[model samples]
Target chain A: MVPLLEFRNVAVDAAGSEPIEGVSFAIAAGENAVFFGVEGSGLKTVAPLVLGLEEPSGGDVLHRGGTIRGLDYLERLRYKNAIGYLHGDYGLISSLTVEQNISLRLEYYSEYLPEEITAITERLMAELRIIDKRTARPVQLTRSEIFRTAYARAVVHDPELLIIEFAFVDQSPLNIRSFMDVLKARGADPAKSVIFMTYEPQKFVDFADTFIMLYNGRIVFSGSRQDFFDSDNPYLVQYRSTSLRGPMAIS
Target chain B: MMDDERKTTPSGGSVAAYVGAPLLRVWRGTVDFAAYVVSIVLSFRSLRFIRLRSISATILTQTRFTGIDALPFVIVIAVLVGGVVIIQGMTNLPRFGIEGYFSNLMVIIIARELGPLVTALIVITRSGTAIATEIATQKWSREILALEIAGIDPRLYIVIPRIVAFSLSIFSLIIFFDTAAFLGGYLISLATLYMPVGAFFGNLSQAFSMKDLLATIVKSMMFGVLIPLISYYYGMMPRSKSEIPIYVSRAVSRTLFTIIVLNVLVSALLYFSWLE
Candidate 1:
């Protein structure tokens, strides 16, 4: 079967920074890929590229063996609707309450009755533990609450693919684990693929089947979970090290 | 000799730059605005894809904000303006023994001119700035991107509802302004000029024409479309927080200028019998 998403020798050029050169990856349906890198390693570009928000400077971003570059209006809309994105900033509409924000996509696209939309939205909000804050605006919600609300909005439509920017950097490991558990429970579809972009690899080690490490806009390592931990590549070693000093330059 | 040559060359370049830059910007802006209008028009095809419930909810919310909330202010302005115009017409027209023409003056100023223009000004100052700032904030927060990611077209979800609301609100507000202004004029005449109610009603009915009504409708609708479209265009241009205020200001100023120009163009066309 064709992979659900693929990046074939993708190179993205950024102004005032190094180009993300020669990046290649493929993710089959049901497979979860985790991308980790230090700040400014071009990991942030991956989400936008896949979302078709930004075109790669070179190479193709394919969705199911087809190029997503030049599709017409309706085709593009269909492609966008098939995927869910949890932005790093949460991307909640400030004017709307949490409930409105969560139900917005479903109500807009689905043929579901109003009652059915509400029921589905309420279910997701409850599962995400944001039901209590359903009436509150984004300004009133805490950081984690915002994340949960955004996550609910993303998955409310049961998208075929979910691309998440792991924003639990300051949270504890237990909180991260619990969030991961919720994600797994909600997004357990065998045909649904996920791409997790994070700086903290250990927290998602158990969740992702494939690991890809990026350094200075290039893939330093891409392999199975075991191979990722076992590799002694200088960049991987540096990443694993707690010290600031390493073969990889911090700046 | 070399210094003089350099000075002359630089001066010539500066002259060309000063003249060429603004011309280029105007050309680019016109092209961009045309493209934006086309995209919005094209997005109408996808309206069926959007849920009717969603579209109606958005339009209702926008109308409430743009029209309902603005009622008190619009009434106040209309009343005051109408009283002033009537006071002036009464004070001067009777001196020339043409006071019978007071109703014509009222129809020309209140119905045809002030109704649409004042309402348009009110909307530009209120809803227009709000739309610009709101869209800028949404863009800044990536809410627009979120909508796109959810496969909800911002044009359908955000722009169309707003355009519809702005148009409807301005159209309704113009009617309200005209009614309130006439009422204010009558009250002013009753209190100060002792003009009989029957006489006022007779004069107004005789002065009013289909042409006046047509002018008011055409101007109000034109202003309505231009205000939101211009504001949204500017709102979508800013990429950063610091640029929000600047773009909002530009949106307001440009919208104000466009409304004035369109108002004149419409009036001139009507005057020249080019439009009915």
Candidate 2:
């Protein structure tokens, strides 16, 4: 089957001196992938491109095997409706409470009645163990509650491809696996998958079925899970075995 | 190296640089403000069910925050000002033995100028700065981007409601200030002197004409328009937390400058129209 999302040699001149240049990768259907690198890796800019929030300077994106560019209003709306984006900070609205944040997506997008939206939102929140925090705003919640709220909001929308942008970079492997487990239980069949971006890949090493590494404005490596760990590519070795994981002078 | 760089500028070049930099910044800022106004206008569309509800809800929410919650402050200020005006009018004009002209001066000063200017100043210091700080906070937290990604239009949800609320709030607060001050002045006259309430109100009515009303309303409305627009513009302009205070200070200065200029224009127009 064709990949769920694909970027063909994409180039984006968004950030500082080094632009993402001629990078290519594809996420096959029902496969969880991680775009990993150390600090300032340009991976953050890469995720927004998939959501069609930013257009690449060169090359193209094929979403569900069709061109993402030049779609009409309704088509673009439909395309966006199919995605569930979880921002790095959870991206929950500060003014809206947790329940309001989750139900907002449902009521706004779908024609669910107020009662039904409330019921659905409550159910999802309860499932995520965030029902007690439903009335809390983003500012009032703890770090863990914020993550659970974001997860509830995204999953409640029931999107085809869930895009997580670096929310779990510092999470323990056990914590990361638990989130993966929740995702798996949400859709047991291989149809549900994730595209997570992070600087810390060791936490996701066991959970990620594939690795796509960005470095120096290029996709230095993109291959199978074992292919990445097994490869002796100097960049992979640097990433995998670096004691400079904390911080270092970049010149 | 720093000393060498400082020495590179000649006296004339330094002067030119000083003048040119501020002028260039002002020009760029004017252009940016114009673009922001156009963006706000373009954001408006024929209302659909959801957007209409959202906009309505936001406007009401903001109206409560800006107008109703502002009641106590506006009243307190108005009362204190009312007492001060009466005391000054009663005592200060006696050197000319023109105590009868006190009511006329009070009417002109309070009704035509002080009412709206004081109200605008209050809003600028309070809500205007608050709007700028809140926008900066939102931008810092990336909540604006979050709204965009969620398919919500920030202009309609965030900017328009604020504009509407500030406009209505300023209008209502001006009316509140004028009424409370006038009544407060009238009450002081009742207690301190033997003048009848009717005579005191009659003097006030004679001095406070339709032109004064028109001028005050026009100035208040113009102030309302400037406060939110300038606040939103400056609030969204900051690149970092360090720049937040700079942007907010600039916004406050711009708001005051705009309100003063608008007050002069409206007064001139009202006077010219009366002459015509």
> What is the DockQ of the complex in model 2?
0.30
- The 10-residue segment with the lowest total lDDT in model 1 chain A: A169-178
lDDT of 1: 0.86
Candidate 2: regions farther than 4 A off: A1-3, A15-18, A65-78, A105-111, A170-180, A186-192, A205-208, A226-234, A242-251, B1-17, B46-50, B55-57, B90-105, B189-194, B205-217, B274-276
- Stretches of model 1 off by over 4 angstroms after superposition: A14-18, A170-178, A186-188, B1-13, B273-276
Query: Candidate 1 — which pairs collide?
Result: none
Q: Write the per-residue lDDT of candidate 1 for residues A218-251, one digit (tens) a residue.
A: 9998888888789887788888885577767896
- Summarize candidate 2's per-residue lDDT along B245-276 as a digit string, tens digits: 99999889989898888887777777775665
lDDT per residue (tens digit) for residues B165-266 in model 1: 988899999999999998976797566777877888788989998887888878877877888889889999997899999999999999999898889888
> What lDDT would candidate 2 get against the real structure?
0.77
Question: Per-prediction TM-score, please?
Answer: 0.94, 0.86
